[model samples]
Structures are given as structure tokens and as C-alpha cells.
Target: MKYRSRTDIFASILQSANSNKGVGITTIMYKSFLSHYQLKKYLSIMLENDLIKLEEDEHLYRITEKGLRFLQLFSNINELIDTTKEYNV
Candidate 1:
């Protein structure tokens, strides 16, 4: 398997959370293919940046509007990169 960049990991986590109503940390880690330590580090950064919010009462995490925007932007960027590669540009 290839190594995933931090941005890729972040996008994966966001996508996972966005798909589920209230995703737990363990679920995100598994879906994102990240180790527990890596997940914790990324989760901390994401929470601090307001990309994801924690539902303390439910003990679950949910993606915020900012995270959705990031995901959309990331997808667009990836598409652009792929197109560039196809054209060898």
C-alpha cells in the first residue's frame, strides 16, 4: 500500500464523519486506515481548527460546515491534479 499524506488522511476522516450521523473515534481510525496515535493527533488538530466538532454528550464526532468545505475543495484539487497528470502538464 502507498503512504497517505496528512491532507489525504484529513480528507478521509472528514469524508467518513460526513457520511455517518455521529462517528466515533475508533470508527474514524478504522475507516481512515490510521493508527490510534495518528488518529488522535489528527483529531486534535481537526478539533482545534474547527473542522470537526465533538458531541460531548454523545461521545461522537461530526464534521462541521468548514470540514465539508475543505472536503469539497480537496476533491476539486485532486481532480485538477489528476487532469494535469493525464495531460502530462
Candidate 2:
């Protein structure tokens, strides 16, 4: 796999969380291709930034509305960039 930028890793974690109702740390780690240590670091930032929430009752993580918006905006930007790349040829 290509080296993923921090933004790419963040997006991947969010996508994995959004893919399910509520997922555990291990689930996100595997889906995001992150190691436990890396995931812990990212999850800490995500929680602090309100991008994701940990549900203690279920021992799971869920994406927040802010995170969803972030994903949508990121997707829009990527689409625009890809469009430009296509035209650059």
C-alpha cells in the first residue's frame, strides 16, 4: 500500500467506524490498517476533537456528525483533485 498521510489514516478510521453501528477498537484497528499503538494515538486525538465517541456501555466507538461532515468534505475535495489530475494529462 502507498504510504498514507495522517489525513488518510484519519479518514480510514472514520470510515471504519461509520461502516457499522458501533465498533470496537480492534475492529477499527484492522479496518484502518493501524496497529494498536497507532490506533490509540489516533483515537485519542479523534476523541478530543469530537470526531468519534466511545460508548462505554457497549465498549464501542461511533462516528459523530462532525466526523461525517469531515468525511463528506474530504470526499468532495478528493473528487475535485482527481478531476484536476485527469485533466492534467
Candidate 3:
């Protein structure tokens, strides 16, 4: 895998959350190709920033409206950058 910027990582994580009704940590980890520690670190930042929310009852993470916007902007930027849009690459 090529080096991924934090923005790329954030976008990857958010994409995982958005595609599912609700996603668990393991699912996010696999989808985002993150380690447990990295997942914890990024998820904490995302939760604190209100980009994602945890449903305690379900033990699942869901994307916030802000996260959707972020993904939109990320897509726009990727279009301009002409980077690969392939997931799980």
C-alpha cells in the first residue's frame, strides 16, 4: 500500500461507517486496514470531532452529518488530485 495521509485514512474510515447502517470496530478495522491501536486513535479523534458517533447499545459506529460532508469534500479533492478511487487497494 502506498502511504496514506490522515485525510485519506479519515475518509476511508468514514466511508466504512457510511456504507453500513452501523459498523463495529472489527469491520472498520478491516475496511480501513487499521490496527487496533490505530483504529482506537482515529476513532477517538473522529468521535471527539463529532465526525462519528458510537451507539453504546449496539456497540456500533455511525457517521455523522459532518462526516458525510467530509466525505463529499474528500471526493471533490480526489477528483482534482486524480488519485485512485479504488477501495481496499
Identify the leading candidate in terms of TM-score. 3
What Cα-based lDDT does every candidate model obtain?
0.90, 0.91, 0.93
Displacement of the residue 48 alpha carbon in candidate 2, Å: 0.2
Q: Looking at candidate 2, what is the lDDT of residue 40?
A: 97
Model 2 regions more than 4 Å off: 83-89
**Candidate 1 regions with alpha-carbon error over 4 angstroms:** 83-89
User: What is candidate 2's lDDT per residue for 1-89, written digit by digit as tens?
Assistant: 86888888999999999955799999999999999999999999999999999999999999999999989988998987764343534
Candidate number that wins on lDDT, 2 or 3: 3
RMSD of each: 2.6, 2.8, 4.6
lDDT of 1 by residue, 1-89 (tens): 67788899999999889955789989998899989998999999999999999999998999999999999999999987753344533
TM-score of each: 0.88, 0.88, 0.90
- Quote the positional error of residue 38 for candidate 3 in Å: 0.6
| Better candidate number, 1 or 2, judged by lDDT | 2
TM-score of 2: 0.88
- For candidate 2, give the lDDT of residue 85: 46
Error at 44, model 2, angstroms: 0.2
User: Lowest summed lDDT over 10 consecutive residues: which window, candidate 2?
Assistant: 80-89
